[model samples]
Target: MSRTSTESVTPTPAVARRHRLPGKALLGLFLAGFVSILTECLPAGLLPEMSRTLDTSVSLTGQTVTLYALATALGAIPLARATNKMPRKHVLQLALGVVAVTNTLTALSDDYLLTLVIRFVAGLGTGLIWPLLGGYAARLAPAGRQGRAIAIALAGTPIGLALGIPVGTWLSGLGGWQLAFHASAVATIATMAWAMATLPNLPGRPAEARFTISQALVIPGLRTILFALAAYMVAHNILYTYITDFLSHAGMAGQTGWVLFAFGVTSVLSVLVVGTHIDRHLRKLAVGSTAVFAASVLVLALFTNAPVLVYVAVAAWGFAFGSSPSLFIGAAINATGDAADVAQSVTITVFSASIAVGGLTGGLLISGLGTASITWAALALLIAAAATVIGGRKHAFPRNS
Candidate 1:
């Protein structure tokens, strides 16, 4: 594993001795996360409009998102490896640049194939960004606030997941699909500039200090973290991927945006709570999040006809899920120590793969079984994830750090 630089150069010993959060730098990372998700999910929200503009079927237009996820999944580790020795800030800059350029091209692309290619490149850029964000935030933080810093940096995820699509959809309605994408491009560009101005420059590690990806995988608890991550993500995506359909099935299709907004709001609150206590209660929080998630899915499975319960379940689900990146990435860094970067990369790869798994599995279940079946499947996976977390208590999610 390699050490990742956050915004700037490594802090001096005197700076490292302080006990304060670098708010601007962490928020820069937050914006990076925001743009990453906003870019990936914007297309899904505007699929019908984008399909019409590109003169393709809705299914084909949807492939833009599919290809993006695949690219991120396939490219994460390799990209992490390729850029391991580069200055952390430069790597971040390069990634932001790629995303900015690709997003602009995606907005301008009239051909579906070209849009797919542009999105794939955008995915690769995100692949590089996701793997380093937590570790980067950790390095940027002073002692005792690493978890808080991670929470702040990763908060962009749930916010983007919550607002990005709805906003993009709104933008598409007002202007067109291209306007939504152009907004993404502009956001990425602005975030890149903020990162450059706020983040310090840290030199890359020497080759001798880096460990192989194989070595990272063999670390004591890395595999367990990755497994739990995969399972949790799969469980989340199953219901999430077809949320609109599930709402439609529940006769609340018109409330899709509001439901997601509720989910997002709770998720942000979850981040705040998790950030405040994560360093002291990592294991307890991780286990509780999984359990709550499972419980929420159970409610969804049994009470689809109850609109009030549905909203409550979705809100609970979001709160349970909101701090996951902070929890999992924080755990991985704790487990692998110096190999945190590699482990983060591996964790991200699994996370992306799980998205594909969840989507495919959800589609299969919905087509053959019904939207109701997806909730049960999500419950089963959540149970597995919870089991792994409890069972790996000694190393993976140790009670004491």
Candidate 2:
């Protein structure tokens, strides 16, 4: 949990007060965060190949994803609370190291249960380190630039989401599923090395800022927005959880690989475009793009049975969900002010919780109502997100909090 050298090697009290991160170092921080996210999701993209090797059915192979999500959801709060005082540099290194070691273990394991355990551990590492990394990114920025800095760091999430799956899929297709973890292990290791050499000491600690659960919970306008985000995410996760499954069942199996490829390509593009925009115009962007998300979901729900629309829906949904990281983090930062880290962790937890809920919701919706139900629920949630964004904007104040 070591911090960057800014705090540890200040020339004087005044200089210490003025210290900030270098440009390359800041970029390195964003890369580190992105790499960690990629490592966290590596197992998910390779689940099918992993299933064949683990001798388990794909449904059970899916447990690794659901449970990894659950673990991250449960682990976020305490990890944020406990590590607030730890050195920023050490925390990052530890997180990256956890990814590296567990990925190696996953690559080496033959047992499915053991592999599941490894994924859980890797998720835990993500929960423990990610909040701090996000908080520190904002802290590392100059006073007015927190929004821009956070947007850059958040871009990592999409980078991870977009790259990890494709890379894992390609590697697994070329060799075995194990190659995915090998690549993850190598990526995280390199990230760890770079983080050790870079990453600045964060200047603030949101967990300790007010030091009260109630206070953190009562962050300005947090409840409505958090729940809105959580709800949308849950719905999104449910739809996404069984995307490949549904496509296969719907006779789009032949195009599944292309769908994923298109989704990845579009996701990266959305992140690049929207992440920065969210930073500068939080309210406008949040309100404007929300319908885009809803429309994307609704269209997919109706047209998923069509080959062309199926591809379009997947790519569009990718764009919609891909823009979330920056918006959510920005909302939290706006709400929490000095408590940006804790707030960010809460968003992560909410996000992770949504994934877990999404899986359950998707499964039940698909089973009880039908696969089409998934889109309706997802669209409903996205509408809620839009409402929340609109509502928050209406009531928003200069509460730099």
Candidate 3:
């Protein structure tokens, strides 16, 4: 899985010569990425309503988020490996179908346990969708355009985070939290149909060897990125999973949607900035964004009562955190080269696990200590992540393109 091997496969000669770049297909992938993330993060906005309606504690309700992430983490590698030889279009369609069905079930279910079960099923779909989409985006990209293609495809995530969660929260306010899930199901169904109609048959290349998780771990650069990514995600999720609650506690309960919306907007802006330069300046972008993120968390921790400061902090947090997945995934792809799918699978697994860890940790902290404690704990992790990035600067971020 050397860089040469990876570069050679990114836009295989057959792929580049046989087909023009499929703009609509990439759009479908983008939508798939969008819907997948929307499904995963919808719970964050609805945690309070869910807790009350389900007759569960807030911490317990937060576990719904934890459950989804854990399921995704647990399932990502096996599913990625199992479907490695299949056509990506079919795999994507099936995964989106799973998302649609499970979310629909979640919308209709009244039982907390049942909803959790359905959410976990939806996680399986997301776990499959991410790596497949990453690889698919790379495959469809013209030679030397893989980074831009990935940036375009991954734009779905920030959109979902920026627009979807806040909008869902607003909709939940108008109707109920179930409305969010129902809306997600509808969106996912439409995206699945669009993908089915639009995505070209992307047959698996049998000549390309499949790389295992063990193989990916053996690469020091990939390992370092994964470690930093884990810490970063854990820190971010700790604050993120309970943001609505944090706002509510600060007497700004009615403003959660607007605050989150502001966060999302800056996130999109930051990701766009990263997209333009990520291919050439991966390490600098990663380290700088992370440093900004830590500083934002520190602001939130220290100034919990200042409305102006809070808004500014949230925007800063959104900008840095929103740009993260693309930069980190790009790092992984760069590290693994030809073994991009394996690297993606591992990245998703670590990402999911860290989300679960963060969510659970926040829940425990909120239950026992306090909400402000989450930011402090998160800040510590972010500092560690920054350290990892600086320490591994030379070896971890070699130019892949």
User: Per-model C-alpha lDDT, please?
Assistant: 0.88, 0.72, 0.82
Query: What does the lDDT come to for candidate 3?
Result: 0.82
TM-score quality measure for candidate 2:
0.87
Off by over 4 Å in 1: 1-17
CA RMSD of each candidate after superposition: 4.5, 5.8, 4.3
**Better-scoring candidate (lDDT), 1 or 2:** 1
**Candidate whose lDDT is highest:** 1
> How would you encode candidate 3's per-residue C-alpha lDDT over 1-401 as one tens digit per residue?
12212444476778666545567888898899999988888877787888888888766776777788888899999998888888988899899999999988887877789888988999998989888877788778765556656776787887776775676678799899989988999999999888889888788746458776787788768889998999999998788878877897777888887898889889888867876766667788888878999999999888888988999999998888876888788788877777778899999899889988987888889999988789899999999999888777655765433
Instruction: Quote the RMSD, in angstroms, for model 3.
Output: 4.3
Which lDDT tens digits does candidate 2 get at residues 1-401? 11122335537767645544355656667777677677766666787787888999877887887777788888888887777777788777777788789889989987988988988998888887667655666767766456666667666776676677667788988888888888778877877777777776554354335445567677767776687788777767777677766787678877766887887788778767775555456666566567677887777867766788777777877787676767676777677766666677788888888877888888888789887777788888888887777777533312222
Q: What are the models' TM-scores?
A: 0.95, 0.87, 0.89
Ranking of all predicted structures according to lDDT, beginning with the best and ending with the worst: 1, 3, 2
- Name the better of 1 and 3 by lDDT: 1
